[model samples]
Target: MEVHAHTHTPRKKWTHYFWEFLMLFLAVFCGFLAEYQLEHKIEKDKEKQYIHGLLEDLHEDTGTLSETINEFDGHLKRNDTLIKLLTSDAIKEHGSDLYYLGRRASRSVRLALHDFTIQQMKSSGGFRLIRNQKVSKAIIEYYNRTVFIDYLNGIESNESDEYRKMAIDIFHPVTFNGIVNPDNTIARPENNPPLLTYDSKTLLRLAGMVSYIRNTKQGLMKAEIEMKMAAIELIQLIKAEYHLN
Candidate 1:
């Protein structure tokens, strides 16, 4: 019987293990770098999209603000005319003019704020996407001012309610409606109705309403003017920053 000695395989050298570890580390590091680059690109694209949308909103707000300013200016003039007529004795003789002016005097100018992009930024926590600090701050301030302006507008609405109540006492509703056309233009009533007749008591009430309106008009003017200025400033800033035409 012959016994053969078992030969054991040689162990791997330390250099071999080291090379294996180095290859694994390099592969993992390269994969991490690739993933980081991809995420960075995606974030950049998202930021541009947000900026473009914000620009559109700003443009719309600017245009609307211009129109609002014109509308409010017209209302202001009407308010002034109504105040003068209601405070003086002339309103008693020319009461027909009051019928035409009452509705215009109480008309509130509503602001059309284009806030869709800003709302999205707030809800999505995407404000950080705007890398420009000035742009971000301007955007925040513009929206914040809108809240105050809206509060002022609510005051105008309350004043309008009061004006309407006073009008009910001073003007005949059927006669007033007759003067206003369906398209909101002034037209003589179909029946060629007589002018509205009011007593001293109604005149006193109308005089008080005129005083309230005179005081309220100043506040409305202040708020509307400030909002318009703010919108213009923000529009300019956004256009400059984004290089928009």
Candidate 2:
């Protein structure tokens, strides 16, 4: 019988086993670190994009606010003139001025905020990207003004509507139709227009309506100024914090 020699493989050393475990652990740790870094970079990129969009929105808001404010100014001045024409004793002689001022007074404007970035951030849960406490707070404050001013705008609309109704109550249909050209431009009658009513009470009631509209516009204009200031501060703060031009 041929005797086969018993050959046994040497057992792995304890240190060898430990080294193998260590290598695997290191590979997993490195992979975790790499993934974490990539996620961080992606978040940072998203943050940059959000800030850029917000900046654009804020600038547009500032411009719109400024223009709206000027429009309110014009509307208020014309309303004041309309009140004078309405209440004046010599109402028959003031037809041209009456038609011009009355038509202008009925016109109204409201602020349309440029809030696309803020809307996106709210919808997308992106407020987390605004890591700076000051920036976050300013953004909140600026948007809050929009909500408050919207309430004031509601009041403005109601007052303007009343004023317009008063106009229809007092002015003759022909005079009303004469003032508005086909293209909606004012065309004062060459002949002095006639009033449907000459009662003192009726004229005073219309004047009172004008006063209410003016009061609402006063509040709206003040709120707009405040919001515009907030927008400017927010813009500066964001630009400084992000080192953006």
Candidate 3:
């Protein structure tokens, strides 16, 4: 009679088992969400580093351009002084050596200016924001046209007195019979003025243009730098937000 009175334990409810399964599923989903967020943040940080490196390269190129322009400007000023010396009556009476030196100086200045113009045009396309090939080509063409006119008008060299007069006539026309006429009927080298023999004015104009180009280059460099800084700041903000520095 005592053996037949064994008690039966209560079986676990199916509803309780279902609840435990749901809790385990929720825990796994939460872990997956956290992992996805961590991976996304890591990818963003890597991209920011890549952009910062590009900006550094642009800064270096801009610095090189600035140095080249400065050196060229110094050369131009020195040439100007040599020109003044050559034009002096004392130097003229001394010998042809001073005149030859003046001619060499003028030639050097012209070549240096041309090189600077070409280099600037090329460098303009290297920037991130200003790297438009079409625009750069247009600018180069315009400069080349102006330089051609300058050279044809005898502005390239101070070697020939005859050529200098021709350049002056092209710049300033004379009046004849109430009409403004070029000094030479055929625009030949034989008929021209003496004042047009030096390249001081053309050099001055080129120098001004160079300054403008330099400013534009600097602006582009600054913009690129700012862009990189902003990206870095955003990365720091995200790291702070997620506490993943």
Candidate 4:
């Protein structure tokens, strides 16, 4: 009987197994690297989007602040004239002017800041995406000042309200209504207008409120100016940092 000898298959070399292990390791490492790069790009893109939104809000804030500042400045000029009339014996002579100013004593010009982006960042933990420490701090400081201006705004409204309350005591509602034109401008009275009272103490007390209102406005102006400067600086800073237009 012829029997076939057992044939043995050759064992794989150590180098061949090493090459296979190396290939598997490289494939896994390459996939991990690709995933990491994708995540990094995503984070960077998200950061730019936040920055763009913030820039828009800031630009809007600057424009609004400018308008508010100018309006308040003009309003303060009128208050100065009002203070002049109310503090002197001349006020009785300028009855038309007195009632004209009195009607607008409580006019409040408010500035509602564009805070949409800032609020979103704060609420959603998006500030962390603003990686630069200096830029972040500047942004925070600019917004912080707005809060102070807002507080002052409340005081301004309160002062104006107090002045209006005083007006009720001394002002003639009919005369005030008569002075207003269709355009909300005040025309000089056709005849001498009369107030409710001529008591010096009461007149002076009403005059005192003008000073308070003026002081509040002055405070608001200073804060508004500071905030505007801050806004400008922040815009420049972010542009420089992020290379934004």
Highest lDDT: which candidate? 4
TM-score for each model = 0.84, 0.91, 0.29, 0.84
In candidate 3, what are the lDDT values of residues 1-245, reduced to their tens digit? 45667699999999999999999999999899999999777655643443344334434434553554454455455445544543454542423332332232322212122234234425654232323344334334433543443453342233334333332332333311112125512212222223323354553443343333333333333433443344344434434543443
**In model 1, how large is the Cα lDDT of residue 30?**
97
Error of 2 at 15 (Å): 2.5
- List lDDT for all candidates, in order: 0.74, 0.85, 0.41, 0.86
Q: What range of 10 consecutive residues in model 2 has the weakest lDDT sum?
A: 99-108
lDDT agreement of model 2 with the native: 0.85
* Cα deviation of 239, candidate 4, in Å: 1.7
As for candidate 4, its clashing pairs are: none
Deviation from native of the Cα of residue 228 in model 3, angstroms: 16
Q: Which candidate is the best by TM-score?
A: 2
Query: Candidate 3's C-alpha lDDT?
Result: 0.41
Candidate 2 residue lDDT tens string, 41-104: 9988998998999999999999999999998888788888888888888888987777777766
Q: What tens digits encode model 4's per-residue C-alpha lDDT throughout 1-245?
A: 99999999999999999999999999999999999999988878888988999899989999999999998898788888887887787667888787777776667778888989888888988888889999999998888897888899889888888888889889888877777899977766666687899888898898789889888898999899889999999999999999877
Residue-level lDDT for 105 in candidate 1:
68
Candidate 1 wrongly placed segments (more than 4 Å) = 1-7, 184-197, 214-217, 239-245
List the pairs of residues colliding in candidate 1.
Answer: none
